[model samples]
Target: MRPVLIAGGGLAGHACALRLIEAGFEVELFELRPFFGGRACSYRLPGYGGSEIDNGQHVLLACCTALLDFYRRLGVEHWIRFHDSYYFLEPGGRLSELRPRKWAGPAALMAGFLALPIFDFRDKWAIVRGLAAVRRQAGDHRLDALSMEQWLERHAQPPRAVERFWRLILLSAANEELDRLSAYHGVRLIWLAFYGAPGAYRLGIPQVPLGSFFAEALWNRYGRLRRHVGQPVDKVLINGGRFHGFEVDRRVVEGSAGVLAVPYHRLAGLVPQLEADFSEWSCSPITNVHLWFDRPVTELPFAALLGRTIQWFFAERGGSYLKVVISASRQWRTWNREQIIQHTLEELKEYLPAVGSTTVAQAHVVKELCATFSPMPNLEARRPGPVTAIPGLFLGGDWTATGWVATMEGAVRSGYQAAEAVIRWLRADRGG
Candidate 1:
């Protein structure tokens, strides 16, 4: 049997390759960039002593089972540090901690929400009602037709609760405003992270750079697997309504089966024959501002900022360095680097008083204009599955129908699904 060809070395592609190799199939992976991780990657900044930093602050919740399984497969589970408590900072340095009470079991999240001082009794009451609605409306297809904002309004969520609570959490997770996000995705996120399982809401931060997750040395044990970095797949060759091969660097690389794991935006140019309609598809942006200070600013490892342009900040290098993330940052797309840096610093000082005294030694900004697809109402119906009309061809990406928003976990799930499809196809072909 020929090697299974996988295109685009992102999480989806790598996950598919690993799964195929484990299933006793030879696999070949091709990537455009020299590195493996696509959006979730780290690079050495040119200035300020070549410090390595992720393009953005990417964290995972314990509800991300597929991503955790991937980490365990690579023997790097220990590199992730999970925090049970979430620190939310208001203006004037008012701090509120949301930590689950283990003794409370399934009701721990509810207890923590009720104890928070940031929201008044009215706000909390509205939120409690909203959560109850979410639990009751599980698996409701009508939610796919409504936006999260509309759902929240229907549930009578007050302005304060919407702004400080729902907007803050959903925007960061979905990378889109509530008005543009599908209520289906929003409700599923809340249910999985907070209400589904015990200890599922804990936040996990990577101790090492994201690129280290797919280091070349890690694939040494997979003898049948081959990697082709810095090579782009120009076209997908099809004959007799079946995937034949891929054209790369003016040469054809044939495989018994193939997986196209690239982003939706790049799908058209590679294989226009599929002719999937993506006219309604749009993107959302995320901006990250990295600031290095002469002195430490805050003791907390990370905090969610309330009533500010900067939504969250992750402390690095003993708190002297910080990465501030602004999700759904369409407004900031026009602002220059200087403007973003200045605004972030100003907001930081309001939450962390020490930021006012500290001098910023260096600052860098990263803007991902197409960070993720906007999870609009009815978009889930448009997301394609692994199987395609073409035989021996499969699709894998976070944008596919993974029943989750675009995240690392969704990406991995798509890959596994594609691999399973490929395995079934091969077995059926061999009369197994």
Candidate 2:
């Protein structure tokens, strides 16, 4: 049996390897990094009672079926705890909760609107109308051309409501602001969160470190597969329009097929044939300031922030560890660690007045300059599929055309799809 080569050991690559191994194929995975989990990896923080902290806080939704399925398959479904209600905290000390009701169908939908504390009568009407518009244009392609802000403005959405409420919702979900995000993507997010299930707005956070939940679980499942770490592939070796293998550390590693699962910017140099248009697929930065407080600030697991410097905050179990995720944090990316910590601490104090005079036990800053691709207009065109022009080569990354932004679920889905493509190609070649 010819071994299938997988380039890059991120979520996509690992997922593909697991699937291929299950399908009766030997696999060899090459990863540049010494560890896995890609941008979603975890690190130990000195504070937080010596608990592990993620690079940034990532929340999964009920609609994340692929990721949930992956967790279940890996036998780590219990590592995630789901919340039936989500709280949106405004800086002015106002809180809104989106809770699920037992009512079925549209009744449940109406219940969510009525239960939300952010919307008034007019705002509720506007949301209903916006949802109607979304359902009406489900099949239209023009939604991709307009930004979410433009779409809402055209519908006479109030500036205050859009800025204070709608923008926050979109930013948290899409990881991009409405002014720049595509209306289609924004609408898709709303559709999935609202219409998917009775309590679709429910949120889920990992109970354990992200690395333990994902990478370790995957390794345990496919630990015996040929694995190489700290060895980055320089380029994909092509001979006569066929992918022969790859060059790692100036040494050639030959294989029958390969999956390039590295990030976008690194792809062009590795595979010159890959015509990835990064212009449309711009990256959005995510900054997470992990703070350990002597006492808990809020009992709520996670809360959204509005009218405050802090965009979102989550309280972990070990201690009052609050993670502030500033999406599209391009400006703050280059700030020195101290400066970043100072600014974030100031913002945190403003949100939780009780922590105003309290001394910080510990603090750390984690920033991902290219955390995920901004889902802007025309981004759909920039993302390609798993199967590339090369006969024995494939692409698998969240940035691919997975219809999902740079997410764990998207990465896993891309890997699953790529593995299926490789399996189909192998079976065809054998005339099976």
Candidate 3:
């Protein structure tokens, strides 16, 4: 049989290719860039003297089963380092750590949350109640119409509690402000990350560059997959509402099946028949300010900063290099490189005292304008499924209806779902 064509070399495309090959189908994956991993990729800066850095820091929780399974398939599971504790730093360098107690079972997280000094008695009470409400009312369809902020207010969540606890976590998770995020996603995130399993909330950071996870040699293990990097699909060719093949470099590349695994913004151009309204679909930005100091700054591996523009920072190279992350960073959209760096340093000095005396040897700022699609209220209903109107053609992307926000896990789930749809379609066509 001709190979199944997969467009986009992101997690979704990679996942689809692997699954199709496992199901006894030849797969051909095309990527526009010379490298793979899509947004979750790494590249060396032109004048950085061969120092490789990710486009953005991509972290996963233990609840990301699909993404982990994908890593296991590539034999790179060991490349990720899981952290048990989450450090939170206040403006004056006050430290608060949240880590589950050994053998405490499901109550471990709750116990840890209660022990945090960041939340006062009233704040803790409000958060505990809010979590209980999330457990009871997570999947209710009515929650989709209301914003997470409104839901929090209706539940009598204190302003301090909302700002210090809920907003910090959900904004980074959903990549949007509470007022713009849907309560359905917010509540679901709480359950998935906190209640899915005992170790569900443990953070996993990649020990190696993100691009290394999808190296060509690793993918070559699957003989059925034919990877075509730096090759962009020009168009999706369909005949009488049936998938034909993809047009690349002004030539038709025929395939048994095709999966449009690109971003939502690029979907209409590929398959115009879908006629989906993308006008309402919007994206959120994330900013990463890389600061390399002359000496080690913070001893901690990673920490979440409170009451500041910088949300989180991950220390690398023995704390000499810090990757400061600003999720939902629409505020910095207008700031220049110098402005971002100066402001990040000012904030870092307050949290990490060592930054006040250290000199920044180098600094680089990366602003991902379209880091993720905003999970706004009522937007979930518009997300498409794997099956499309055209036969032998499927859609695979994190923006699709994967029951999760635009995370690595959602991307892999979409790919697996699309591959499953193709398996059923081709099997029925052959009467197998």
Q: Supply every candidate's count of residue pairs whose N, Cα or C atoms clash at under 3 angstroms.
A: 0, 0, 0
Q: How well does candidate 2 score on lDDT at residue 236?
A: 94
**What is the lDDT of every predicted structure here?**
0.91, 0.80, 0.92
Lowest lDDT sum, 10 consecutive residues, model 1, at: 188-197
Residues forming the 10-long window of minimal summed lDDT in candidate 3: 101-110
lDDT of 2 by residue, 271-365 (tens): 87867657545788888888877777777788777775568888885437788788888778779999988888777666667677767788888
Q: Model 3, residue 338: displacement in angstroms?
A: 0.9
lDDT for 343 (candidate 3): 97
Q: How well does each candidate superpose onto the true structure, as a TM-score? A: 0.99, 0.94, 0.98
Rank list by TM-score: 1, 3, 2
Candidate 1, residue 338: Cα displacement in angstroms equals 0.8
lDDT of 1: 0.91
Q: Model 1, range 1-432, lDDT digits (tens) per residue? A: 999999989899988988999999999999999778899988888867989888888999998999999889989999899999999999899999998777888878877877899999999999889888988886787899999999998999999999987888899999999999999988888888668779898999999999888787888778999998899999999988889989999999999999999999888898898898999999999999999999899899999999988999999889999999999899999999999999999889999999999899999999999999899999999999999888998999999989988899999999999999999998998898
Q: After superposition, how far is residue 179 of candidate 1 from its true place, in Å?
A: 0.3
Clashing pairs in 3: none
* Candidate 2 lowest-lDDT run of ten: 215-224
Over 4 Å off, model 2: 45-51, 104-110, 214-218, 221-224
Q: In candidate 3, what are the lDDT values of residues 318-363, reduced to their tens digit? A: 9999999999999999999999999999999999999999999999
For lDDT, candidate 1 versus 2, the one ahead is: 1
